[model samples]
Target: MDGYFPGTQSGPMDTTETFDSLVRAEFSPRTSYLNTASNGLLPARAVTALHEAALMRAEGRPLLPLHENVETCRAAYARLAGVPADRVAAGASVAAHTGLLALSLPPGAEVLTAEDDFTSVLNPFHVRGDLKVRTVPLERLAESVRPGTALVAVSAVQSADGRLADLPALREAARAHGARTYVDFSQAAGWLPVDAAQYDFTATVAYKFLLGPHGAAFLTVPEDFGGLTPVLAGWVAGEEPWDSCYGPVAELAHSARRFDLTHALFTYAGLRSSLELLEELGISAVHDHAVRLADRFRAGLATLGHEPLPAPGSATVSVPGLGVRQPELSRAGIEVADRAGNLRASFHLYNTETDVDRLLTALEA
Candidate 1:
């Protein structure tokens, strides 16, 4: 059990080595994959891990190892998020994790949100019907936090154009107004450094920048549980799950485990490998490498008279009015997305200079 959750420690590099070896050994994309914002390509290790887990099921082997994989991922995410392992809860849907916060808010309380933030971050609040879901432009979110704001919900990185939220500013405003903050990190984690300790709560799906499959999510919460009543609590959320199996849970989990939904066991089996690979590479290195590629793409777009959405320091570049070319690019063997009328391409540690140049060449043709 102690071997389940591993610590993240990448020994110092003396500058002679590069991430080239690790990436080359781990990934072999058949096409130019620049769409990590939509979905990341799985590393070879994760693919192998998934296949093994499926085989275990086919052989009717004990699921204890796969169960162990969930703890490994949760711990990895906690270290990546700069939180305690006990503070992170495993789940499958970010919207479902968000529902905990939405349901916690009293009637008529306001949930301040960025106008175009991802829907999963805002939908839970709206579905509550009793909570006031206020929308302002992403740039105006921090300034818009008022005394009426009970919670400020926003994506750490805008899913549409990669615009990063002013988190430090938002935190300050929320504190001044005695409000809580919920940040969705689905678009930024793994490449952009995340510290969930700064916000009241944070949710991230493992499929995007984290380079894992869909259906695995992690949520971090305050140690005191932030007064959140787990409305969907099942037996897994019990203090002693096996003992609590037959009753209305005798005692809820003392930690954030109380918020745990059933683990996506298969997803977790693969995600453990993904998280391990990310930790080995280091987020700072990944950020610098990806952002450089994005800047290169932006420069190329400028030369082509194509202005991208203005998002400095982001690894994702979205070119407005070029969404119509998505199919052309795809046919040209480039993977990207047409998001909200923009051609969105995200660069990851696995992407190369050639990948960026190929997209530029396609755009020029």
Candidate 2:
């Protein structure tokens, strides 16, 4: 993996230098892609892995062997999230995992969450009419926790305004109230160091900052989590799925693997490749580089008489003025998102200072 790319260095390099090399080695210069919050651009190595997986499938290879790729992906995600590999479960999407978690919670429970969080986090609990759900501002989340609160669910970073949640404080408050904590790391996982160990449950969509294909995601649950019942039980979730088919009683896996749903095997292979690249580059370096670019973009927007939202330590920057200009900017080969009436530009390792300049130039024009 050291020399997987041509001219790749053997040891660590400066973050900027590594990013420049990554831009050259991984991505094509077709457009200034600053929409990682919406969908990430897959690196060349990940694409190659996907291609090879497709070729194997075309050659009539069994999908059973690819199950190992799922474990490999789970381990990679666990490493990134600073949790044990056994605590991780592969899924098709954040919604699937959240729904499964919702089913595991006590009936008629009270849940607290942020209104600005992604819909997947809120919808699952909402659809379960038995639970009482309350939405509050992210800054007030810690204070909003009460004695009756059964679970607190929120995103590590708000997708709408790029606001990061005070996860440590929130976790502490939830724990004080004897409530469990759940975090959606879809926007923060690759670019921000989110320790999944801090929360009782954590979920991520691999297609975003993880830089993997769509339809692949994972969830992490605590080792001692009780009330372990699988609402959408499948043979794969069983401890001995092969033997369970012939038995009268079904025994689920003791670990978080019991929560896993069926997923695309090739997607896991692609995710493993991207996760390995992330590990090699180092998440802290990626976070710093992305934050620097976001800061630069925000400062430049401010100088141009636009106010970008203040979101420290976030790769995404939201500019209200640029929301209406998104279409024109897209025509100029600049990619960004108009999320919830704010124009958002999300930076990643493949982005550079030049890309920020291009975005500022497009906005100014």
Candidate 3:
């Protein structure tokens, strides 16, 4: 084990000069990776941590540290979300957490949603079948809230085109109508400067902008657990998991941990390091860096006589009818996504102006 792990290195590893320095230190993308909306590249630290974790499992060493990694990731995400750790529940998917939220609603309750939002956000309500699911254009979500609307469920950032929801306006609208809010932060949390505290219920997957691996998702609920029953609660949701394991859970946890599901321990081990890297970079700085890159891409597209989807301040830029070029671009070592006939390219803190220009040059060719 001693030889398997490297000696601990301290300090920022020379990150003080600029974000570019940190990016240079942590990553070495072989391509101009412009597809964070798909999945993020892991930092070197996270990859190394994961490798060591797997080796520990192979050697049958103590895995108790893996559990500790889960709690560290939970707390770090709470800080990123601007909420107390006690209110956040760690889970595996937004859809699973939405099942818990769906159970809290009475039959026939009206659920307002955005049209074409990620299915992970929409499908859960549809599965309930008894509730009324209403869809409106993304721009009309806030104004669509009305009396009898039991819940307002939508993604904070549209996954298809990267348009941002009007969060402040949406929050006010939900309050005015007595409707509760559930926001999917899958595409926004890491670099969008969002506050989970602003919404009653928020769920985010860490693999996207957060740069964690898959199999890790987070749900934040109000102090009262939003009146939702933890129908899927297992031994982990008990006040004392060890003590309650043999019985019907003598006492459930009083906090959001009541909804706790067993985490993917090895993934969590690596995610702990990923979250540490994100916290070090600071979300505000990441936001500016990503949005700046996206805008630069959009301007380049305009000069080439192609217009992108009208996403004013999003970190994702999607050019309409240009998706046919995706194959050629990929062959040239530029990574991007083509979603529903739109050429989609999302930027993150690790990307640079040079990456943006490489993609533009490829698209022009």
Candidate 4:
């Protein structure tokens, strides 16, 4: 365990490994770009662990011992999210877990959520019935909470604008109206601090901030919440799986694990490795790195005589001048996401101070 949780030394291990590999491939010119937080680049430790797991799978190991990995990953995520291990559950994606929760709600109930939510969430809510959907301005989110609302769902950070939400306030409003709150922390996981024990339920994809693969996500359910249930449960979610008396009569697991209906041991092992790596690099450090980079980017954008979206203290900050045909910026190989007439730039730990400066210089040109 000491070897696994290397604390702040995790980055050094990666740095050393990268150095050694570079020595081996010294002659090869590399096009190094940071995409760890975006596409779930596994840390060296995690990659090694997953490789071992894959080898075991190739040998046809029975039962897979995935529960151990899942439990281990759950413990790490719980510690990071400020919740008990039992309160946390791992799934293929936050979308799957939240969708199960959404399905468990009263049919055709009004679910008040943000319009800027991630596409995974938007698609699920779109096909659901009895949805009284209202797109509220970011500033009026607190004022917009209404009575009889089934659920108040919002993203901790907007995937489009990279803005952080007032989660504490959102939680308060939902509780006041007797509505359950569900937060999508996909973009905020590694870059933000959250106490899941303080909220009704929170879901985030492991791939984004947790630095895991595509099929692993996590959800934290409040210790006591009756209105929300796990609609799509599986043998794992049910207790006494090996019991003779089998059927829907099986009792669900007494914790949030009840939300996990399908199991993917391969992905679970990979996620466990990633979670271990996250434990190594303390959340506080990771958040500081991301925020510093983002602040730098924001400052640079301002110097270019353009304003970012959502403003400072707004829900998010969409980059300016993305679509403009800037000669040097385009030639310099800078790219951004354009959505709803706004450009988006994201920041994370893998990003450096230099990256922001490069972006700023290119945009200025």
User: Which of the numbered candidates is closest to the native, going by highest TM-score?
Assistant: 1
Candidate 3 stretches with Cα past 4 Å from truth are 1-18
Residue-level lDDT for 87 in candidate 2: 90
Over 4 Å off, model 4: 1-37, 242-249, 311-317, 321-341
Worst 10 residues of 1 by lDDT: 1-10
Candidate 2 ranges with C-alpha deviation above 4 Å: 1-19, 242-249
For candidate 3, which ten residues in a row score worst on lDDT?
A: 1-10
List model 1 lDDT by residue over 171-202, tens digit each. 99999999999999999998999899999999
Which candidate model has the greater TM-score, 2 or 4?
2
Cα error, residue 140 of model 2, in Å, equals: 0.4
Kindly list the per-residue Cα lDDT of model 3 for residues 72-188, writing each as its tens digit: 998999999999999999899999988888888999999999999999988888998999999999999999999999999999998889999998999999999999999999999
Cα deviation at 191, candidate 2, in Å, is 0.6
Candidate achieving the largest lDDT: 1
Better of 2 and 4 by lDDT: 2
Candidate 2 lDDT by residue in tens digits, 19-52: 4576578777589889999999898998998998
Error at 231, model 4, angstroms:
3.1
lDDT of 4 at 221: 82
Global lDDT of each model? 0.89, 0.83, 0.87, 0.65
